[model samples]
Target: MTKKVLITGFTGQVGSQLADFLLDQTDYEVVGMMRWQEPMDNLYDLTGRINNKERVSVFYADLNDFSAIARMLEEVRPDFIYHLAAQSYPKTSFNIPIETLQTNIIGTANLLEGIRQLKEKNGFDPVVHVCSSSEVYGRAKPGEVLNEDTKFHGASPYSISKIGTDYLGQFYGEAYGIKTFVTRMGTHSGPKRSDVFFESTVAKQIALIEAGFQEPIIKVGNLSSVRTFQDARDAVRAYYLLSQESYKGNVPCGETFNIAGEDAYKLPEVIDLLLSFSSRHDIKVETDSERLRPIDADYQMFDNTKIKSFIDWEPEIPTSKMFKDLLDHWRDEIKKGKVPLNR
Candidate 1:
């Protein structure tokens, strides 16, 4: 018997990588739910690599519409649901706070309601793994390590929305007897990350400079802020492990796990690392006021003991290797003419 797994935000970095991981499995059928308006280029690239279209399916639906979500849930009846859809960028949320709230909060409620309806109608409950963020912790005290029980003090509109959705998942699980596990992830990055993100932007700029397509100037924001970042590949693997633990009844419903990286790195340190991979050593780093956040945390870290003990998961990708892979990915994109060098 094949178990059907549904992944929302299928076109995003983590979701797409998760799909890649699942495509290698034999007994799980993967269904990706994405908005109709989203471009299909990433999906195309993903499916092209998998080669077996029969094992994976893409469903076009909006999370805001409960009816559509319910219908899709009824049709797929997925054994597991990884909810990753959201307005994910923190800085952009400052400009579109309302839209972020609608997409992240209401969107989460609709998905959970759809699962509840399915459970009521057919007594079918899927193990839902909700992707939350460490940003919900807001400004951690200097040198303090945040854990699952840490109080949320969301610093940005995006984090606030994530906080709402995070608790919503818990509420649905505890109140309605639905199976929900929230994974509060740290800053995970790798290949295919949007250029708007700090690390990707740096890597992209370096790649462009290396290709002689752009000038040797890198624009940056708060270089002193520190964050723990995991590789997207490693983070998705942990998500899969948590889902499996839920399915095996090893992880309790409504439990939240903090997926933290091995160490925290300052923004300047990361930028320096990317510079080391570049061909041009004379490249200038310019601080852009527009790129800086209105409110930024000085330090953020996560304590991953719970996840480690429960799933035996730890990040295997080193920081140097992660940045190298990101730079390599950008270089490939540049060579393929997919990335526009002019900013």
Candidate 2:
């Protein structure tokens, strides 16, 4: 029998890629939760077009309703649950703290509660994978790379909500015997990611300039702040391994892992790399305060050795490759008249 896996946020950057990876390579039947729009049939839709209609399935639902989620859980009874849904954006969280808390904290609790109830009655205990962000670390001490043991500062509403969810998963795992694992990830970008991300912001600007959709000048923000970035595909693969290992009872349960690249890159270095890719190295770069994060970490990097040992995984695509691929993707979108000058 094919294993059934339930995933929330299947339309998102990492979730969608994860769904595709599982469906195409494994025997898992993926049932994805689509909150806003109708879910696509496969990975093709994420690439801006639909190709396969049979590889994946979707259900329209919101994450806030525990009762609704309970129904879905009972029906699917998935062997593995991947929770990737969140109101994710540090700056935006300041604008909608309540919504962020409700979606991240309450929504997570709803799923944990539903799953716990289901396990008690039906004797089906599914392994859960929660995607947390490194932002949960908030402000890191100098020269201190964030590990699972790193204490959380949670300076922003977004970080606070994630910290809540992270603890919630742990509490449920210990109290209800639900196998739960958390991946507190750093910045990850790829071809299909939204331009709202910093790397994508650079890519979009370059794409616009290359396509003549905008002027040659590129707008930037906080170019001195440093961040670690990994490929979204690589990060999703780590999530899968962590979820599966914990489900099989092969690894420690109720633990968290940090997933990121080998090194942190300064914002200016990344911009320079993109400019090199676009062959527009001479292009002017200007700062825009609108893009500045409310509270910026001095430096952020993840110690992924815990996950690397547990899952036998390593980041295959380097950040430079990821940067180039993003630029190339946006350039194509621009040429196809898909990306506007200003987003």
Candidate 3:
């Protein structure tokens, strides 16, 4: 019997990559729930490569609508659910705080409620993997290495929303006997990363400069802040591994894990790494006030001992290698005229 897997936010960075990964697995049927308003460019290539159409399906559903989510859950009856949908941009969340709360918090509640109803009706409980952010750690102390045991001190509206979402997963799992696991993801970058993100924005600018479509100037913000970057592929693989554990009863429900990179890098170091791969030698970096976040953390790193002991998971892609892939992807997009050079 082929297991059915439903992934929300299927068109976003990590969700799209996970969909592609599961499509290659013959034993799973991938069902993607996406907002109708979002663009489908990310899944365009994956849609073409799918040889077994019956094994994959895309459904239109809004996370904010409980009825819509419940109907979809009943229809799919997925054996595994990966909830990755949300207003994920942290800076943007500041501008649309209300929308962020509704989507991240209320939206999560609807999904969990829908799953509970499905469990009662069908006597089937799917293993659910909820994607949380490392931002939930807020301002880490001077030399603190964050782990699952660390207390959450969400600094921004975005992190606060995630704090609620993360705990909701735990609440549903413990109170309702639902299989739920929350993953606190660090800054993961690679191909298909949104252009608005810091790393992707820099890579896109460099690609445009190299293609002679733009000037040799890279706009940046908060270069001194440090972050641990993981590859999106690696992060998604961790999601899959955790879900498998939950499904096989190897791991306890309501547990949380931190999926982060092995090494940390300052924002300036990341920019320098991208510049090293660029063919443009005249590129100049300039600090942009508009790009700066209202409240930024000086340093954020994770201790992955918990996840490492649970599964045979480790980040294989180095930061330099990941940056190279991102640059190449942006270059191809620019050369093909898929991405505009001007704002």
Candidate 4:
């Protein structure tokens, strides 16, 4: 029988892209775990395949609902699990801190507990990749490069939640002997990038400006932070390779790696670059106070040396291509009469 793989959050940008990668490159059956009524926008292209059950299927299970997650685990019994579901937006986490914490922190524990119980009973040993965020290194000191060992400083409620989630991934593996590893992926973007994020919002605004949907003023928040960018495509590739390594028993349980791109840039430079791809050259930048977060991850330089040594991976997609693709994605969305609201 072909091995089954479960991907949580398979309806979101990274999750959907990871599903695409698995479909294109592997023979494994893809089981996507998502909550009922989650947006299907990202996975629209795979609707036909998902409906046909052609190596793809959807399982309705919310992470917060332990019974649902447990039942899914029992039924699916996947050979690999890529846990990527979470309340992923930092700024939004501020307004809904309690919900964010509950969903990200406790939600992760529910999944891990299910795995632990199933593993003890049935010897189910799936290679699990617990996805964490570089945001856990929130409010990094200037000029510091974050690695796996860096002491975490939660800058926002979302970051604090991820710190809990990160610890839970390692705790489950070490305490229960589950085959799992955690990844702290740096700021990643490309097509389907959400408008709430800095780079994507600029790209969306530019697309809107080009389409005459809005004025040429690009509204933004704080742009003083410095960070690296990677394509979600490349990040998912790294995740795949790490899963394979874990399956082969090459990766220690709960081992953490920093997967990020090498290219670094200031926020303003990103806006300039995205604007350079626009049809309209008259666009101007304006500061929007509402867009600013209460507390932000002001610096996110990462040390990806560990991941490179484990897996033959470095970011292959250029920042230029990623930005252009994001802009074009918005343009295509607008053309389809799916006008995005200005945030």
Q: What TM-scores do the predictions have?
A: 0.96, 0.93, 0.97, 0.99
Misplaced by over 4 Å in model 1 are 49-52, 341-343
Give the lDDT of residue 66 in candidate 4.
97
lDDT of candidate 2 at residue 208, scale 0 to 100: 84
Off by over 4 Å in 4: none
Question: Model 3: per-residue lDDT, tens digit, 1-343?
Answer: 8889999999998999998788765469888899878888788776754445757778899999899999999889899999999999888888999999899999999999999888888786999998888989998986799999899987788999999999999899999989999999999999989887889999999988888877899988778778889899989888888888898997777889999998788888888899999767899999988888888766788999999888999999887889999999899888777865342
Estimate, for each residue in 1-343, the C-alpha lDDT of model 4 and write its tens digit: 8999999999999999999999999999999999889989999999999899899999998999999999999999999999999999999999999999999999999999999999889898899999999999999999998999999999999999999999999988888889999999999999988899999999898888888899999999999999999999999999999999999999999999999988999999999899888778788999999999988888999998899889999899998999899999999999999999999
TM-score of 1: 0.96
Q: Give the TM-score of candidate 3.
A: 0.97
RMSD in angstroms, all models? Answer: 1.5, 2.3, 1.5, 0.7
Point out where model 2 deviates above 4 Å.
36-53, 341-343
Q: What clash count does candidate 2 reach?
A: 0
Error of 4 at 63 (Å): 0.7
Candidate No. with top TM-score: 4
Q: Local distance difference test, per candidate?
A: 0.87, 0.82, 0.88, 0.93
What residue pairs clash in candidate 2, if any at all? none
